[model samples]
Target chain A: MAKVPSELRYSKEHEWVKLEGATAVMGITDYAQAELGDVVYLNLPPKGTALVQSHKMGEIESVKAVSDLFAPVSGVVAEVNQAAIDSPELVNKDPFGGGWLVKATGIEPGELANLLTAAAYESFLEGLATSGH
Target chain B: MFLTPLNPLHRAAGARMVRFAGWEMPLQYTGILDEHRSVRRGAGIFDVSHMGRLEITGPQALDLLQSLCPTDVAALEDGQGQYTVLCHLTGGILDDCVVYRQGEGRFLLVCNASNRPKLISWIAGWQRRFPGACLIDRTEALGMLAVQGPAAPGLVAEALGTGLLALPRFHLGQGLFQGDPVLAARTGYTGEDGFEVMPAAAQAPALWRALTERGAAPCGLGARDTLRLEAALLLYGNDIDESRDPFSAGLGRLVNLDKGAFLGREPLARTKARGPAERLVGLRMVGREVARHAYPILESGHRVGAVTSGSYAPWLECNIALGYVEARLAEAGTVLQVDVRGRLAEAVVVPRPFYRRSAASGEAAPREPRAASAGA
Candidate 1:
């Protein structure tokens, strides 16, 4: 089973988001890393760049395949994880902790409604797992 | 829907299964890099039962095979195997296969999984020319497992309770393990010193378990690709295919012109006289990042060739690849750029088999290891 933190919101693409006032912390979900398999390279968005919700922010290349990281909420990019860039395998080791991709500030309040809660995302993953990837 | 004899074993070991060539084979057990390194430094066993096998027997078998393959099959002694390509009349490669001459009038032809149907049709079409030959498809009756690495010989010897170290490369022998027949051949796709074991289908799972218990690490198709790439061995579909000629793929040594008339002899002779326009070359990156398949090779901002197989070599510690380039640029030490993703990455042409081993000394030679990683 994949880890789903109750405090965070998730996108269908498997990115997790944590809101702190107007800023939101973002990273890949545990399920995403398990599916990607041994991340080798990470192309993260530059700090201070603005991103739109549901748009591709960057890409993460794993041993099996390369996946595009989608933005779950719209905001200006506040910080990008430099550590993840140095060691991409950390993403596979801990997708929710040190493997966080980016942080964004100045998000619209209505964007939270578009993201899925922990229970809903867990059910969504169950459907994907049973449906056979 | 597809499964190997070791499917349960793979699941127990936490392997990630993926569909490859109609088989649900493990893509990775621990991880691609870890599994790859285990094969390089120690030992690894691969469940290659998915590869198709055919047995051609009878007095006319040698003559039939000699007429089909481009290699000199008549020169092969009993218990020896030779890698050859079956080509069309136009000189295009039909399939690359290994022929094992088990005895007089007996032979085993191993082919790629995807091309089994096409090869069967091609061979059947030519059967009328040789009236008294028997071609039997033994893919379902046999299961193959490859034990590869520096420690392969010891592990295999322990498993079969026989001294296989005396067997020279490309030689085959029959042995008994637990009262079952096992065909052990010193043939492997990985550049390492290894052996491929062929056993009856009913005995596959037990043999696999025994080998695992005897210290042979379980590996999947993912590591198999990286290991073969490091050794400069060509993968049929990815490296060489129907559209490519043997001469253009740097497989000129396998073609024998003096052996007389065979399939695709006319075009091969002509192509030999007039050198191929493009030839296969090895590429070494200037940095850590990798250049994947289909990446364009450029010389002075112009497309010179395209990459067919590219990966980060685990043993070499660098990013390397095999690709087709204009004959002029195929020379070693030629500086070029590979368009990786959207940016041009600096690369240089190098000799094939990026990893070299001294056969006489049984030690790896000194070379600067490249710093890149391969994809599964």
Candidate 2:
């Protein structure tokens, strides 16, 4: 029942990325949001900060616990989503849309090779469920 | 994992079950924040049958309890209960318990689920000296439910009648449910005015149904934990354990050394003369960062202490934590830092019980209400 829009590519760490030309939009996936329960706070890098592929960028905290946020691609941060920062529950409500965490540009297009397409991500989720995650 | 008597009922209510202290109990029915706020603002019912319930009876029951617990159990008249701790010979804590004097020669001890097995063996060892006393594990035979919040007393009164409503806080009384007697005690871990009721295991489903129908939200362990933390009630394994003593854990007020030769009396008396070197203090995060367990507490750049328990207090809407620090640094207003996953997050020593309510006969907790002002 987890939403996986076919247009976006996903990271194994549960981050999703949508490439529009040289620009990329990123946010946590539906599976990650459901696992996090209620999102309460966030600590993402400010604009102009550099990000490394698969590296920890910041933290996401819920009422229950805290988790590290990993970057899906190597790029210079262009803008951090101000709306999601103001109201974290938006991530729990809409992980794919208004909950987008970052917008960055200048990433190599070949980064898609390291990310999974919608079809691949769905199977990965299914594998996790069968293994009792 | 072990199952409570109401396991099936919890599943039927769509509660998300999780393993805690060897039992598969509901982590949440709807959500932890929702359930936590319900108990703080109104009423919530929790199926706490997984917690241990032990009964002791005999002419020497009082004598045995007095020798085992640090609290002055001899002073508890019938129908009264006191929050106390079981300690080791070296003054280390064994477990925290609420000892209730339910009858002339009978007593009931409620303990944490994780410490149940250890407590049974510990009490048995002490029972050998009290020849006339007997210990019975009633945890499996009875089902326990905690109905808590501001409206709890009214809900309980309506469902079970005026018998339990008439009892004051920390008192016990008897009431009828379907013509069967159930013991109701005015005690709870959530710092809310409420009653913890003990019914026959077979009647658990009916009791749960009746309470929920009467407007008590079916809560789970997740909210129960958050509520107790906001009240600053120590979790046995997470906060206090065999390695820490009551004095160091900020429970010295419950120790009555002059009462007589209890389990930790000798060492506790010595500790009373010379204050504990480390004291448990409350910590308020200055921002969104959380200081989880084992995270180092820093004074300047050196490690001073570590967090025991930390989380976002839903009702209070702030991040709070409990940790042990040097006696000199335990005072409120002392600023410190927590190494939250390698990043230094500013924190300050604040007063305990991050939240309080009228249900427990306490003033509103005078702690940081907002993380923004915690730094100053």
Candidate 3:
């Protein structure tokens, strides 16, 4: 089963966001990384760049295909994960930990309520698995 | 959906299954990078049963093949194979295939899976011209497996209980695996010292088990792609198709005009003198980022051509690709730029086979001590 921690919120695009005070740490879910297979390159948006909710922040190229990374909430990109950029395979190695893509500060606090909870995201992945996508 | 005889074996090895050319095949077992490195540094086995197999028999088989293929089929002695392309009347490639002469008036044509139906119809048309010949689609009857890498020969020799050192490249012969007939040939799409084994479908599971037990790591289509790309081998649908001529795909050597009248000979002869506008060349990226297929190859600001295949060559530790550039830009030392995701990645034209092993020189490197013994 894919790990979905209760403290983290999920996006429909399979990104997980952990809220720490006013800042939100973002990383792809376990289910997302499994589907992507061997993340080769991660194109991250520049720090201090303002991103709107549901807007593409960057791109991730795996061996199979390239996928656009969408922002779950509107906020300023305070910091980008330089570690993940240097070793993109870290996303495949540890998607929930050091492989986090970005840290966004000054995000709307109300956006967290709209994101899916751990149980909801798990069920969503279940549907995808059965449908053979 | 089509499935290889070793589908269950792949599942047992934890391979990720994916649909490819109508076949439910493994896309990767452990991972593409790991499998690719195993094939380069050690050994790897692939279930390639999805490749179409057609057998031609009868007194006029050789004559029919000679008429159908662009290469000189009659010159291929028994137990020998040659890479050739079947073409249409207008010099368009029908399918690129490996023709193996098993016996007098008997040959096997191994073709790409997607071209099976089209090639079958074309062969049927040729068979009608030669009334005495017979063509049989034996794709369902045979299970194909490719064992590749530097250590492949030793493992294969140990498995078959025979020394294949005497057998030259592109030659096929009959062997036995646990008393079952096996067609073992020293040929593969990956640029490595390897053999493709065709065994009866019933025995495929056992053969796969034995090979895996003998330390041949299971690989899949994902690794197969990277390996072929590193070798600069052409993938049919991506690199060349019916619309592309042999010269444009850098396959001019496979076409022989002196052999006389055959399908596409006239147009090929005409194109040979005039030269193709676009030519295939190897591109080495100046940076770490990979330039994927359909990425534009530009000289200054002008788009010269497009990338046909590209990947981060794990063996070479750099990004390499194959692309068709303008005839002037196809030179070995020409510097170019590949538009990779809106960013221009610098590239330099290089000779084919970005990774070449010295095993072809017949001077074998001293074998490393077996890993199992070292740990024990």
Candidate 4:
């Protein structure tokens, strides 16, 4: 079963956000990691780069395919996770914790409201799995 | 999508299935990287039943094959196989094939699945002129498996209760397993020592089970592709087709121009006299970026060619690709740039067969391994 911790918010693109004060720590969800197979490389934006909600920030390449990473909320990137960048397999092993991709310092409150809560995201995934898509 | 004989087995093993050339084939069981590494370090078995098989029998089987195929089929002794190509009248490639001489008057041709129907009709049309020859589509009647890697010989021996290491490369042998007849050929697409097995379709599940239980990691098409690419193997549609001829694809040795008349032989001879405009070469990326198919190849800010197949080779641990470029720039050590997405990444031309075991050890080929040349 895919892990969906109740404290984190999610994006339809399969990104997860753990909000700490005005900063949003973002990473791909467990379900995303599973779908990606083994993560070999992560192309994350540098610190202080401006990001628009749902826009492509960088890329995540596995052995099979290349997927674009999207920003969940409009913000300025505060810091890119060096640990995950150094060892991409960590994203597949611990997507919710150390695998966090970026920490955005100035997330827009209105954009955060548009993100799905953990419960909503779980149901959304359930709908996707059941719909046979 | 058509199902293979081992469809149920793939499903039971939790393989991620996908449609490939009209067949519902397993794309991956665990992950492409894992399966790829397994085949490189140990052994992995792939259900390749989707590859088309044809049987030709007649007193003049060799004559018919020689007239159609570019390779010297007449030179093959019984139980030997030769890689060859079928071409159009215009000298464009139709399909690449491996023809095995099963007996004195019988031959088995293995071809790409997607080209089956067209090839059947193409050969059948010529068979009409040859009174004694007969053609049969054995694709649906037989199931295929490729057991590949350094550990393949031991695992195959354990599964079949006999050692096949004695069989020389490009040789075929008939044996029995689980009361069913099987044909084992010392040939594989992956640049590893292995066997390609063919048995009755109904007996596939039993063989698949036996191999998997004996530790032949059940691999899928995803790994099959990456493995072949690292070996510089040609993929039909991507690497060669109607637009490319054998000489241009670096398969000149396979074409027997000295042999008598054959389809496309004249055009091939002409093309040989005036060398191909572009030549296929291996490319190793200087950076981590992955170059995918159709990505532009640049030479000093000018577009030169496009990538045909590219991927992160697990064994090589680097991004490698195969592509065609102007013949003048096809030599090894030539620097090139590949446009990955929007950014141009540096790459270099290298010799084919990016990976090969030391010739002194294992069942490594005595000759330098042939570059996966041409699409046949």
True contacts kept of each: 0.29, 0.57, 0.29, 0.71
Q: What i-RMS does each candidate reach, in Å?
A: 1.9, 1.1, 1.5, 1.1
Poorest stretch of ten by lDDT in candidate 1 chain B: B367-376
Residues B207-298, candidate 4: write the lDDT tens digits: 88888888889898989999999989899999899999998898888888888888999989989999999888899999888988889999
- What TM-score fits each model? 0.94, 0.94, 0.95, 0.95
Please give the C-alpha DockQ score of model 1.
0.51
Query: Could you give candidate 1's per-residue lDDT for residues B299-328 as a string of tens digits?
Result: 999999999888877678778888998999
Clashes of 2: 1
Alpha carbon deviation, residue B56, candidate 4 (Å): 1.3
lDDT of 3 by residue, A10-129 (tens): 999999999888899998998899888888888899999998888899999887668899998889999999999999899998999989999999899798888899999999999988
* DockQ of every candidate structure: 0.51, 0.66, 0.58, 0.75
Count of clashes, each model:
4, 1, 0, 1
Model number with the top lDDT: 4
Docking class of 4: medium
What range of 10 consecutive residues in model 4 chain A has the weakest lDDT sum? A105-114
lDDT of 3: 0.86
Poorest stretch of ten by lDDT in candidate 2 chain B: B367-376
Q: Name the regions of candidate 4 deviating beyond 4 angstroms.
A: B161-163, B360-376
- Of 1 and 4, the candidate ranking higher by TM-score: 4
Candidate 2 residue-wise lDDT, A1-133, digit = tens = 6899999999999999998778899999999998788888889999998999999998898877888899999898998988999899899899999999998888988888999999999999999989877
lDDT of 1: 0.85
Model 1, chain B only, scores a TM-score of 0.94
